[model samples]
Target chain A: MTTHPHMALVLSRICARFADEERHDLSVLRDVTFSVRTGSFVSIIGPSGAGKSTLMRVILGMMLPTSGEVVRNFSRPAMVFQNYALFPWLSALDNVAFGLRMSSVPKQERERVAREKLKEVGLLHLENHYPAQLSGGQRQRVGLARALAIQPDFLIMDEPFSNLDTITAEELKADLLKIWRAYGITILMVNHLIPDAIELSDQIILMGAHPGHVEKVVAIDLPRPRDTRGALFFQDVDALTEEIRKIS
Target chain B: MIRSVTHPQAGPWHRIHLMRHRRALILMTIVIGIAVLFGISGYFSGVAWPTLLEAVLRTTYRLALAYGIALVLGVTIALLVGWSPFIDFFFPFFDILQNIPSFALFPLFIYFFGFTDQMIILFATSSIVWPILFAVLTAIKGAHKDLNDAATIFGATGFRRVSFYLAPLALPAVLTGSIVGIAIGWEAIIGAEIIANIAGFGAFIKNVDISGIDASAVAGALAILVIVFVINRLVWAPLLLESSRRYAE
Candidate 1:
């Protein structure tokens, strides 16, 4: 029941459950409480079935929490889905412009802004390619561009890089960081990769499942442009990984 | 996996337009050419060309009317059946309804509508409606969950959701279903004409010299083939290709 002036989003004791097909009670999320700070990058990291995605759905208002409240002080929140979710029928440019169109932006302005966002995401040249024609990394870039084109107050990512290969994932992480820094937009992401959560986030909300709830909140106070190869960075990552493992 | 054959540097919209128009143009040309050939052969065949033409035209109009009714009603009914949980209980009834032979109802329909074009059109519609309805139902049932989520998240609701998301997603199924429906419609329309001894292609075929099947009857059959070819090319082929390019997985 507390609110901070600088808070972008606040989740107060949120709970979500759904009945199975056979009408069996199944609790997916329970008693989850957290706040995302303005312009901060936060990662919700946990093992699969830890309600990471369910928590996201609750925040996005895609699914109603069985109980509790989510308070948002921001406007125009957009999500980048795990599987890219780009319309297969639309080319990259049209896909990126989709949100703008939904918001009733004029066609000319929508395309211009979409192209600019595509450029920012390093996919301007591939804007004419359909999602089916793009590589995994390229498709994710389109997804990111689409989310950014809406000029959201905050961005939600559901395992944004989990679909890519190792090299592509790394490249995308750097690109995401660049975009986040440049835009200064608040980001709340769900990731199962412990190292990624440690590396990219300003704060990590570690979670545990079986009726999923928050386990611990760990702050990654590491300096920006973090050197992942450095021993201190590795030490921090290892510690965070161990903490997550112990909780899960 | 499903790249269009366009110039490497072509803009996406430009390519889309080009591909659409190009396929449409090709199909139109084929249809026109077939119609012209049929016209030339009919002129030389020395058959009662005027009566044959009248019957063909009559059958075309009737079939078109019946198909139109079926398309509108089929899509509407299919969407209604697929749309909500309340309607879901009626699906088992629909399952049984679709399996019932539409042709078997012709005699019963004659009793109701009494040997008129109304009966024939209704009979043809019965034959046409089921395939489209079933195809759309299957499409709705198998629609991608992610796409549904995306549409909901993007604020496509009510009519907007139906027009933009559900209709487009169900398009491939719609096209395939229409093809089947139209084919069945052609059969039903002709059979109705013959059985009812109505004024159409089936009547033309039935009344022809029965000694060994006259050249005029052969010409009539060829004309029907030409119509089918034209429809397949101009209507179904272009749609099928477009669906493969945009809608199909």
Candidate 2:
């Protein structure tokens, strides 16, 4: 049971297994346990075989866990993918409105909400453009807008800024922080950059490979508007990097 | 990268509509040019313009009916086979069925529909359907995993997935497949007409070309070539350009 008050999500002894070509079970995740605090930003950092992506899918109920339990306090959850998997045939506006469209919302209402989300992401002027017509960073913003269009209380993101250049990524990070604060939603993200997690997260969950499991959960108490160049920020980044190296 | 290339005045969607209008104008000019050329040829060669025009219309109508039937039937079957859990079982079986010599089925169709327009139409449909079916099947098989996941996440499950995701995904394939199918349909319809002694362009030509390869045959060939070129310019090419722009990733 979660002793922490206001827990948004909880995973108890979660494990995932896939059958190999030879009909043998290959364990991918084992005994993974974690709880995400309500309205908090939590980041998962780990090595290649750490099954971070699998865990996220399991949490989203896209993939079934072989064993263990998931308790989600929030009803509406949305994900921002690493690849910005917008439907190529749809314009940015239609892509943002896709969820409401699927649920049979009236066209006018869905478009109104989609436009609002796009405006929030600063992509309202480019909403009619197709995914191929948008740059990488713009596409990611469109993706963020799409996830937000559903008015989700729980936000799940998988390396959402990995494909971006430094300047674009930094700008997006600032927007994300502002949106997080305004929405007061809980966010669970999978990322590799140590300094990024330290800057944006309240707690970081570190996982290890070879039957992936949680190694440690480090709490970040850094002040808001983090100074990346400061000694304390570098100290946390160095400590996190060292911990991951040990697991690797 | 965040602010890359935003069109302040007009987006690509606007440009595409403009391009379509230009394509329509160009197609009209080509049609006029072909008509004038054919008129001069008819004036000199003592060609039976009325009879040839009737034959062309009859052949075109038959081919159009055949293509319509084939398109709907082909795409539906392709979706079923491609998305089925038994794709591995059905796909190879379908491949073997498509390999059967096309003309070999004419006798079977004739047995059912006889030496009439129905026989010719059915024969052409059989030939046209294979390319559309196989093309769509290949497209569905090779679609990206990420797109599939995205569609599911956004609630495109059950029959909704067919219309919202798979159909559009198979659109470019449908265009290419129809082009190939129409070419094969021409051969099938002509051959069936000639063998069955039915009244179409094929019969019209065979009646006039008794001495083999005369001015009538050349005029017939030229007319057919012009029709093919016009269809390519007005229909397939424009759609191809639009599909590439709309669906490219």
RMSD (Cα, Å) for all candidates, in order, is 5.3, 4.1
Complex DockQ per candidate? 0.38, 0.62
TM-score result, candidate 1: 0.84
Candidate 1 residue-wise lDDT, A1-248, digit = tens: 56678999999898889998999999998899989999999999887778887787778778899999899878778888888877777889998888787777899999999999999989999888877668899989998898898888889998998899999999999999999998999999998787788789999998988888999898899887888888878998889888876986
Candidate 2 docking band: medium
TM-score versus the correct structure, for each prediction: 0.84, 0.87
Residue-level lDDT of model 2, residues B1-249, one tens digit each, is: 577586643677668867886887687678767757867766426667687788878888999999999999999998877667676788899889999988888889889999889889989999999999989988988887667767777777788788888888898899989999999999999888878879999998888787564666766766787787778788887898788788877
- Estimate, for each residue in A1-248, the C-alpha lDDT of model 2 and write its tens digit: 44545888999999999987999988999999999999999999998999988898898788999999888888778888889889888999999999888889999999999999999999999999999889999999999998898888899988998999999999999999999999999999999898899999999999999788999999999998889999999999999999988988
Task: List iRMS for all predictions.
Answer: 2.1, 1.2
- Per-residue lDDT over B15-50 for candidate 1, one digit per residue giving the tens place of the 0 to 100 score: 676687678668767866775786687643667889
Interface RMSD of 2: 1.2
**How much lDDT does candidate 2 score?**
0.88
Model 1 lDDT, full chain set: 0.83
